[model samples]
Target: MTLPASAPAIVVEGVRKSFKDTDVLRGVDFDVPRGSIFALLGSNGAGKTTLVRILSTLLAADGGKAAVEGFDVGAQPHKVREVISLTGQFAAVDEILTGRENLVLVARLRHLEHPQQAADQLLGRFGLTDAGARKVATYSGGMRRRLDIAMSLVGEPRVIFLDEPTTGLDPEARLEVWDIVRNLASQGTTVLLTTQYLDEAENLADRIAILHGVRIIANGTLAELKRLLPPATVEYVEKQPSLEDIFLTLVGHGESVKDRS
Candidate 1:
């Protein structure tokens, strides 16, 4: 298939990785479009985390080439780091510091001229303005997660790698994080997310790749992926609604639905 004119935010060709004797990624190839959300779905030990680490420049691939924002991940690590941000499954906030302080620290680390101003703006944007003065230890899980994501934005990265960002968040908190991600995409940021929750991938990802056995078994939009399976009718009781209906009610509309029927 022909790709768009815009440069890919991420590009991987024949990427491979191994730990000791076990191979993690086996000649993986994919391209994530700029200013779009790409979901990488995989079971535990399917090498999703390894792929994220390699893209983030935290780990080097054993073979092949990978690039982020047109900069080679292995050759131009500094340039890749400058344009990308990575948020792991767990929040990494300083418990001793206030939310505002955490953002300020990140801003300073990124060499922002006005760290305090940038911190305040991010705090307000993430709905933590009122609790900015409280220590991170006093913040709830959701709050800390928000703070972690806010910290990643301190450098205004063009590409973000989110590995199960809402893993431990409550339903409400997950929605909040989803909104934040949507807003970032709307602002022209490229997001590459690894998620276990199929619903989360369906909700946020413009494209989804299902990784199994160290390779991508499926790659497409949700409808396209679903279409790969044999067609079947979903039976439901007239009076009793199904889980799918409930999900549709709770999560609102899915973009894939329109394309399916």
Candidate 2:
């Protein structure tokens, strides 16, 4: 599918940053198409968080430029902030406030007049309606993570920066969060997610970028990246037919038997 000629949702060009004597990003470059899920993958200390910080206008880059939703992150930080919301690795909700209250607070802070209504809507959307009245401190980790994500959506942002959103959740809870993210993208919200989970990227991202040693080492769609590696086939026998055989039977198959293992 072809994208429009309008500016990309995110554009980073030759961006560089460093702390003390350690360079975290060295002339990085990439673009995220509007209304698509872009995943940035890397190991710990690969500068994923630092790049997020710079794009979210929380930190300045030593050099180069980045624009989020058509607003220069450095020159027009306020404009960038207006169109984007961020959820860091850790949940940022206020523990003392009730889940509903926390959402209301963010809505009010964003100057929404009908904060209560907005908060209630988001609560329902995230399946937190029943727990809305409970204090965040009493909520489970999964609930807190959901609330953190909901808070980020309070202002109806067009671009969202999710920094390792599922860091500490269990498999089921992580899947719950992934469903929420998928719904967001379906509604045309541009998502720039940084994660260490390859499976997470494979499941949710429209395109993936792998960062190593403070630079992007690879970038492409899942199938495109997989094409870079050699193909392998597995053979097994079972009395009950295999799911792969059923799927291939239904979808039709090709005869590219590169290997049988």
Candidate 3:
């Protein structure tokens, strides 16, 4: 779906951040279109998280400017907070609370009308209605993550920042979370995600920006980024199996594993 021709949902212009003697963000900048999924890619300690924190208003920038939904993050933090939701590296759902209870808590906190009904609708939407009454402590990794995102959605945020949302999940669980991200984009919510997995960005991002040395070295669709490189020489190479491939081979889903005699 096409986003409206309005100001970007999030904008960072020459945003800079530093810690003591180390510079974290060196004049980084980007524009995230409204209702689109924008992926920020970087290896560990590459300043992706720092940039995310600055844009989300959790941390202040040393120089430059940032905004969310056209509201300045530093000058109008309350307005920025009103239109954005964030889920960090770890799932924030309470283990002691039932899934339904967890969402209801956020709904009530948001002062939503009829919080319980909202919780039920979200639970059903995420395919967790049957498990809604069960305690989050008993839920699997995927279930807890789903509840965390569901909780974030209680207030109907216009923009959401997901910081490495699939960090430790297995491949199948990761795919499960991917579906939810897709659903958010389809529903017209701007999503800004930072990920270490290149494949995750390839799979989910409508636009991608690669962060390196505290800067955005490249930004474009995957195909546009690829075009910057020399033409590839077509050659065949042996495919090495990743751990997830082995995991899938050993623990098949939606189909029976083939018997290799």
lDDT of 3 by residue, 1-261 (tens): 223568689889999889999999999989999889999987799898888888778999999999888789999988888899999899998999899999999999999989999999999999999999999999999988988998999879999999999999988889999999999999999999999887888889999887877888788887776555434443464333332232223223212112221
Q: List where candidate 3 sits over 4 angstroms from the true fold.
A: 1-4, 235-261
Error of 3 at 70 (Å): 0.7
Can you rank all candidates by TM-score, best first? 3, 1, 2
Q: Tell me, what's the RMSD of every candidate? A: 6.3, 6.9, 8.1
Per-model TM-score, in order, reads: 0.88, 0.87, 0.88
lDDT for each residue of candidate 2 in 84-150, tens digit (9 for 90 to 100) = 9999999999999999999999999999989999999999999999999999999998899999999
Residue-level lDDT of model 1, residues 1-261, one tens digit each, is 223558788899989999999999998999998899999987677799999999999999999999988889999999889999999999999999999999999999999999999999999999999999999999988889999999999979989999989998999899989999999999998999998787888889899887777877677877776565434444452233222322333233332333233
Of candidates 3 and 2, the better by TM-score: 3
Name every residue pair that clashes in candidate 1: none
The list of candidate 1 runs beyond 4 A from truth reads 1-5, 234-261
- Give Cα-based local distance difference scores for all models: 0.85, 0.86, 0.84
- Candidate 2, residue 121: Cα displacement in angstroms equals 0.6
